[model samples]
Target: MGALARHWTRIAVTLIPLLIALLHASGALPLAALDRLDNVLYDARLRATMPRTMDERIVIVDIDEKSLAEVGRWPWGRNRMAELTDELFDRQQVALAGFDVVFAEPDDSSGLKRLRALAQGELKDAPGFAGRIDQLAGSLDYDAVFARSLQKKPAVLGYYFSSDRGGGTSGVLTEPVMKREDLRGRPIRFTAWNGYGSNIEPIAKAAPMAGFFNPIIDVDGVVRAVPLLAEYGDQYYESLSLAMFRMLVGLPTVEPGFPRDRFLGRGYQGLESVVLRLGQKTMGIPVDDRVSALVPFRGPGGVSGGSFRYVSAGDLVARRLPPGSLKGKIVLVGTTAPGLQDLRSTPMSETYPGVETHANMISGLLDNRLAVRPDYAIGYDVVVLLLAGLVLAFALPLLTAPKAVAVSLGVLAAVVGLNLWLFLGAGLVMPLAAALSMVLTAFALNMSYGYFIESRSKRELANLFGTYVPPELVDEMVKDPDSYSMTATNKELTVMFCDMRGFTKMSEKMEPVQLQELLNAVFNRLTDIIRDNRGTIDKYMGDCVMAFWGAPVETSEHAHLAVKSSMEMADAVRKINEEHREKGLPEIGVGIGLNTGMMCVGDMGSQVRRSYTVIGDAVNLGSRLEGLSKAYGVDIVVSESTRQLAKDFAWQELDRVRVKGKEQAVAIFWPVAPADRLEKPQQDELKTWAALLKAYRAQDWDNCEVLLLNLQRMNPKKFLYELYNERVASMKLLPFDPAWDGATNFETK
Candidate 1:
């Protein structure tokens, strides 16, 4: 409940199914599928617990293929049926008999009507024809013959009710089991029909005790239950099974049974059961909201099925069975012949015989084992679902993984177990599909929400980082997907430009494929070093590979990383040069530049082609520094801004120069080595070089020459000092400039 207040969105999502199930249960928005699922669940439970043992007390007299073959096709004259009835009662001594077949029209197969018509029309002049027809009239009336056989017998005839007839009815309907006055104006809704197909007047009047044999077909067209009582023209009628059971128990009159506890109060639409009244004794036959009872099928149907014994009508009519063979047995006479069309699709079997359903019901009524979806079933479903739904909705978010699983499983088990207990222990058929579905659905949704929220973001970020950085940096870079995108923006970032030298000369000596392979190899080594330090590769252009930092993801040590990768890349080229000497390949030289400044870093280009790259003056200056590296005879050059930010390395001030596009001269430096790794001799050489630049810039020719001599002696291989020495010597012969700022200016890129 508290989860609904706090995590209302997730709670609301889980409640959608619950709300639909509730609506279905309340009859406001009926879900035919839900009812079908309930039937499926019931069928599963029924099949698992079926006794599979034969019921000796109840038997089915099947009018099957063998019977049809032996005694002609069905409607074998009502005179033959009268013989079969007499054999069941007088010879077989069955306790009660019920017909599952309807006799809506007279049995005219005897051809007596045709003979009388011929006598009145064409044969009227033949005096013997009329006289002979009158003589055979008493013996030829098949319906009257069958009716006489039913009189004074414990026989219950069968009929069917229908709603598609448009009030068109045939034959005569039996008296009501209970009248409208018996309900006392409670407005109880019974299964009502518009028309019926009952027995002819003679047979119906002979055996007035009758019931409709219409099993209640659910929306999915499966016979799960049968209405024990139905309504027709303000009169309630009993079912075949109920009628047979009532006659077996001394023909009790039926009364309406009302439940004392209908929680819905005035909204209750049906009775709990039909009360059977006999003297002061009354027995309650439980019914569902439709005044129906679920058939407690013992096992499968048909004669081969072990649920009930089957006696063939042909064998019984031909006296194949000995006298008293079915003594004291309650028999249901129904046909299984293909022509009869009595087969129905039941939960147990698709081609189940219709008569066995009533037999199962009769057996249930005998043992009081009829299962019913009670009048309070909807109320029960709502209460159970609300409790279970509330628990899962509120508890799942609060519990840990194992505890949540345990709680959900416990609730599911409780709901299923309770439902099964009602089915197997007490004979009750209640709604379970909705409750179980709600629990499983709610649990699944709640558990997935917690599990996928973080993982989903991590997965997306991993894809973004997959190509930008090395495999090792991906885990750390998975921060927020919303934090970065291809959208262009301005931020202070560090950009580096690395260019390969002597590439044109090397290509002249080697084949095109060989040159391509060599260039790729050199760039691969450098790119690995850059990505190793959290740098995003911008693009590879010719022999140069550009990279930057603080994008897609941010890092404060962007300049430090840029310088570090630059030094590492220079060393890697030296190793490749060593390999080149050993393998008889051309040596490769690298020049790298590093600068730190505010720049726009994002995906920017034409709509047809785009890239995640950087643009601005800082980037342009970094490129110029790469070009100046060859002029100054150095492998790596860094801008003053970068040197300030990256204080970990020993710096050598190279120059203050203006590139083609810039007016302001930015100071540049060379990273000699790590500050702690520089030796005393190297330190002295750097100081002497700094002094040489100071004297040269001040126009002290003698001091500059003296300082250059000392710097060359300290590091004779250093080209920067030699270059400055040449400049000083050339300036000695010319007039010294009064406005020189000691800044070199480059006229072209």
Candidate 2:
């Protein structure tokens, strides 16, 4: 009981997320957000698993922009429709031609009926008008012409069902594929509609067959599937794709495919498939719980997919296409013109052509490749989620961080791999969002619990050490707290001191709050760069900042990171200045100094309050280098130790100087650029400077002066050359000492 009391917190932590995930999977707590996310996941899976090869069996006769331009506008007099139809069968010899457009209104663009009326009422006595009108009647009767053309062909007309309850419908609807009596006692659910818009009576009677082109839109406004059979006023009608498939298969009889278990006391035998019977041969077409088949998008979308050939409607009417180009192909006449508004959002694309959607469905149905979400999809989701969730929940508490991460990643990969396998291998598309979300959410919850609850010491350590060290280094220190302490210790590390130039002058013109804001913004950028490069910030003093690297987290590349941070900080100042210039404020500049040596670092101060900081002669030298930056007229000055350790950067020797309170002379250098970015011209300039420095050390004033002049000419605005020229002139006026090392000594810092 004592052990149970101790472990109760951990058990609760593990079970909480599992219970939430289980509830989600069992549909007891449905998330609309997750359902929407599931749609996106399904779309991604469909795109990845589709067979994107072109289907030569189907072709789209598009009333595209070109067709609209060349052949006037849409509903182009029925005579033109008759000409296109005749050209498809008579010239191209298509096997099956279907219209994706409905002839709901009569085409009167020919004006033949008006002409007849005018001839009888107003032009009866006019010179030869009646005789001429009678001669042109048969040619100009465009509706009759279009009807006669569709009379004997294997042409199927298209219409749409109105799901809107208040929408009134017109035109003549054909007979339903199955009657209400056929599915009387069957426990099947079909999508029902209130009204429909069918073809005009003359065109409807003329076409060999007809079907509705209505698509079922999901909650997210994406059309992923089409209902194979829909109900309207107790009659079941077929979709365009189903009708086309049926006609091709000798007009098979439609029947429900119910499992045998349904007869043996099954509660609700889910409608699995729609069985098509032609003689003794039967084929089962799978449908989802909503009685819709998932659309098998062959490729990205539209003409680019190449799933079907697209021939312009104008091209067919004008007979511009090659002979037999559409031969034996099942042609669908539709429009891709934006004005026609036949576009729909689908899984393949946001603006997919509705016509090819049907074509893809037809092709998928014939090939038996339509991915279906079976009735047991929710059960599969629940089982996977519960099992995987429980595994992670129980296992994560006993494992370390790295092992926990590996286990969680392995479970996620397994879930994704299995879902994809089912989709690609068995043509089964199950819900993956629930399983994936459960795994990810559970993993996150478990990790959160471990970090915030079980590992309180790590958090406390971070809170204590985060201000002095970077977050990453603090994390490293937390791993072994016994090895880290507030007691001072001597360690070899690199320290940096950075101060803004002319900040006092800039502040004189600004309000206190404005100056504070500017300082805060600049420091934020500099501090972020320092931390990003693995340097620990020690403290901020006035407009200056002091930071060090290689203490909390010992790294051999401490000098390299310190030097790199210095260079990036200088660049960051320039960017800030650019912003200042755009804002009509004074531009500011910063100077940085870096030194590498052994220093004492720990929490140190008076007994009243203490803080983590570094102290020693090496730290003082870093501050002295920052002060010398203004004297040298350069942005950055690093000690000789830093220059040697940071060999991967391009450096220019500034001077050999013995700073205040130091007798030993140390060489200082300015970081020019990174090694990879240094150009050949800069290398040549460095060589010239080296020769100049050598001559100066040798007390050869003439050659040193000449080199300074040449360097000044190369970079007219460079102050280093001028500073060196002045130093050489000053030294020439004084008596030369042969024992002198020619090191400039600064008496003040």
Candidate 3:
């Protein structure tokens, strides 16, 4: 958890996709890819669940190739259309017959206009041709004949609406299903058109009911839906399917329906359903946000699809069917001839019949089945994204690798399953693309954060500090590895510089390999001592080993640990010398120096070699102290800084000397042993040594000689007492100087 707390940046990255998706969902920004994917998903789902069974209520009267062959090609005079209508109503007795074609131009195949013109002109002066032409004009006028056949019949005509710049002028259109005032002056975004191609005036007045045959083509050129009601000028009109249904059920008046909200009065228009009001009773048809209905496709189109019973218009017109064979069936007169240019791309088929689109809508309307993409779909998308996205972001971090993957998959499944359930069951086509994309992207980001960022950080820390500390300490650092790096920093730490004394003479007595083995053996023991005290070994220079404490890992007992490690290393070297004596090899000497102060410690070097070592004046002093150790006849030399912090060990102050590269003299000391281990005689020797040092600094030659005689008499074998006696005898030759602070100075390292 602590490791996770430090990486807020990685956590924030996982939620970025969700934020973008939310912005898209809320309409602040829109993404085209998401919308396209949503359309693809919707198309797939729609195709998977389509009912292939036929709709028995609707039948298509196809003007197919056979019909065009038998009836002698298209635009076969209006008189032939009149005959087909007669066969459908008078003989077959269909409950309703709708023409999916428009008579936008007058039928002039009978030559009645030419004959009448001739009779009124030159022929009226010559013979009785005017009277003769009047007798044949009744049967020759094909438009009048077709119009008379459709008068007061159960029929509705299909026209087309266009968006052409040149407005319609060749036909007559019916009144709109509803007017703008019906919507209470609220602006609606209905699919609008500027022009139309309707039937001629004679046929239009005769039928007195018509609707446009236009399906809404999406950007991909597939007709997925149809606007049940659309706008033209300031009025709203209904599609052919809607008009046919209205005519079938007593012609209900259309009125716009809105969601009940007080905001409606404040100019917020949210059209929910289209209401067909009949007196006190009303029926509502659900529509999408654009006042459109999804085309509930029954199956693939064409006569082979079996979605609707297909009857060739030629057979129906030629009286081939037995009388009343199609009694009470709703007949839709449309052409399936390819040259007619009525084929459309739909979800079920690429060459779907334009007319059957209306047939399906009618069937769906009859069964009250529609899938609506509601206005609240954006809200649904945003909610699902938040839920699934947040789950992956916060939960994946706490889980192990396997669990994180499992949890992410589980979240994705839940999101997809719920979306599909709503779509298939409740007829709600909500936005699933944004939610699914957000979930999947968030999961990917989280896994990448762990694999690429956090895990990589752990590996880097292990590689950098692994050799400095023990494995256990390395493991602890890896948890929050960002806290440690190779960058140099200033820290208060204890630095140790232990050099092998008499290494030059020792190396001259052996060959290279043997000498290397001896040196490695000595360093192995010293390294073991330093590591045992939890100190970091900085580097090894020839026979000398440098180390430090409280770096890469920190502790308040750095000084004490360094002092303890130095004594252990000195003892281990002596033990190694004991084995050397038995092996007939030269005995090696070890001199160690320890100091504690603020110093720069970390990985520092050029490109070729990098080392985690300390650098500062204090570290230099520690090195100088190591050289002074042999001169003082002691095994370990510690500065006053280290001696003050490490109080567990008994200390003997050696001298106050100004070493090379330093102006002020610093006190130096030697760690004898634990204070409890010092005997009374050793204590008396140290007291005598202190008195001798005080008398020597006072320039009292007689007192110094007397004290040194007593200290040397106590332990004449001690080199420290003999060296101080030499120092006292040599100082007697120099005259007393008042400027001196009773400290010795060394000019060479």
Clashes of each: 0, 0, 0
List CA RMSD, all candidates.
13.6, 11.0, 18.4
Q: Over the stretch 642-700, how does candidate 1's per-residue lDDT look in tens digits?
A: 99999889989988899899999989999989888998988888887788778777888
TM-score of 2: 0.64
lDDT of each: 0.86, 0.86, 0.87
- lDDT comparing candidate 2 with the true structure: 0.86
Candidate 3 TM-score to native: 0.62
**N/CA/C clash count, model 3:** 0
Residues 535-581, model 2: lDDT tens digits: 88899999999999887778999999999999889889999898998
Which should have the higher TM-score, number 1 or number 3?
1
- In model 2, the clashing pairs are none
Which portions of model 3 show Cα errors greater than 4 Å? 1-4, 262-268, 454-749
